[model samples]
Target: MDTPQNTALTRALTELPGPLPARGVIHIVIPHTDRFTVVGNHLAQHAGLSTVAVGLAVRIQSLPQGTEIGIKALAARFPEGEKLIAAALRELEAHGYLRRAVTNLPNGRIVTRTVFCNQPTALLRPRVVAQRPAPPQTSPPAQDPAPEPPAPEAAAAPQAPALPDVQQEQEPEAPAPLEQEPEAPAPAPQDHAPFVARVPPPTAPRQPPPPLPQPRELTAELDRAATALLSDLRRHARQLVLSENDIRQLAPAVAAWLERDTHPDTIRHTLTNDLPQPLRHPAKLLKHRLTVLLPPPLPGADDLAAPARPRIAVTPFQTCDGCERAFRAPTPGHCRDCRNAHAHGPAQAAA
Candidate 1:
């Protein structure tokens, strides 16, 4: 079972110049740890170094020295078969793990090589947690949980002390009243008020409310970054941060804090939500498109250059309200069903 090539490959991985069990192998294995899930999920797709497959590749060597090992040889001895092994290694390298150091083997052919890696190639994950079965499902009943004890029947409200219905006191029908004709009286008050000219009270004008504080304007570049990050995060659980906004609402105070106070690399300004579905994690759609609103103020830009006019963008609002479906602004308001329902309140109201 130990051909010279096989033996050399095994020896390279096992004797990798490292100090951990299965020495050189941990570079491949450690990344698969829970510590790197976010970056791991991102990389496996974009670059391929998902830790599970990569870690197993390294661990198979069981060496304890330097992690300097020939990748071709490691690939050969991997437990998960060479095809997946090469795939993982290629993925790892593409995602910026061990660089490709070409080493000339004794046969004078250039062989691909791998260097030991102790640092992560992608975003930071202080610790990667291994997946474990959810702690024995103590979650309350999915349906029909234990019935709540019946609330004690409210003590019958004390019967209003029965005041005998007063009206039942049959006042013997009042004896019939006599009828009589009356004489007309003369008018006299008009002249008294005439001298006091009819006075009308003065009306006071109402004050307008103070306007809401204006938010900082966002920039186009900020919008691009926000959208890119949103798409990047979607691969992971939405709970991890799925949907993102266009990035325009951040107030100046908040934008300064996000750019200056937060860690340079950590998520700065973000909002998230939980959604219902097979995609169990909540999807967080961004509220304000941020990218356009966060950059340094542009020189000589003015939003108010013309005479005031009421120009309401009723399209997106109308779609969200009337169609019950999300649509970009400027959707002709002409979806077939929408046309059929045009008689609905908003369409008719806007028209």
Candidate 2:
């Protein structure tokens, strides 16, 4: 009968045709000791260990000492994947199937060594040994020194300057000219009459400004109308509430309808007609109806109710981050539904 090491080597040899390669061949033996048997049996006892962990442990135990195992390598070999393989490694270590030790070198470098055990055991802490001083070197034997070179001489200084001669040559003087009469001042511009011979006719009197719109008019009552619309919407679906900002947003849509010469009542009727049983956002629904469902004007009526032309430079309202459902808010934040959900979360939790 072959020993465990020989048995493993023979099994490995079976994979090759006839002869084993001289290099790159690793010999690993599955120990047949009682400790190894106990460890194999104990693997099944770890309820927390997943199938991936068990597979990793078995693979690690089958490898020769100092064999490299990397995440990408393991991922390529096993179907469990790198993430699961990494998680499994942690689980294996936590359950004592693996022990890792980090050693620090005298050069301030750190090296990590992991030991996989067929049987689980406590980890061995790293021990750092003090570095010893190197031996002193002997002095070299005395020898004759080389001769020194001579220094160069300094340059001589210059002599003092002599005194200058008096009376230098001068240029000839120019002759004076006779005086002449003084020049006269220029005359001022003559006074001129206005461009027009006669004054223009008196202008027509300015007309008084048109009277301000009354409460009945949609323009003046836009805010109140928006509020009223919200109240009516709540009656159909009770979850809707428009903030002041929300109400202000609806004014432009209502104003568009008014500009189309659409009666306030007709606009409201068209909006509330055929409403859904459950409405998530009343403001969004109102905006869509006002902008899209708005009726064309009657014969000989103005088309001012048409949507404002879209411009690339002019950005529309921001979409809600929570649902991306509505553009009623000015900034990218959670919508009312998300806000309500957050507000009622505590109450729901208590129940």
Q: In every candidate, how many clashes are there?
A: 37, 0
What is the per-residue lDDT of model 2 for residues 1-351, given as tens digits with 9 covering 90 to 100?
A: 455566656776577555444457455444575534233656856688897788788787766667777677778876777888889888988988776789898999998778777754222433344445444576998898896764443224454465487555678767677666655545434333224535678798987633322233455566566556645655554545666676667766666566666776776677677766455567777776666665555555355466677776644576677777776665577878888888899999999
Residue 335 in model 1: lDDT? 51
lDDT of 1 at 328: 58
lDDT of 1: 0.47
Residue 338's C-alpha lDDT in candidate 2?
85
TM-score of each: 0.19, 0.23
> Each prediction's Cα lDDT score?
0.47, 0.65
- Cα lDDT tens digits, model 1, 170-270, are 56778788865544444333322223434677687786633322334545544455445455544544444442332233233234424433332343334
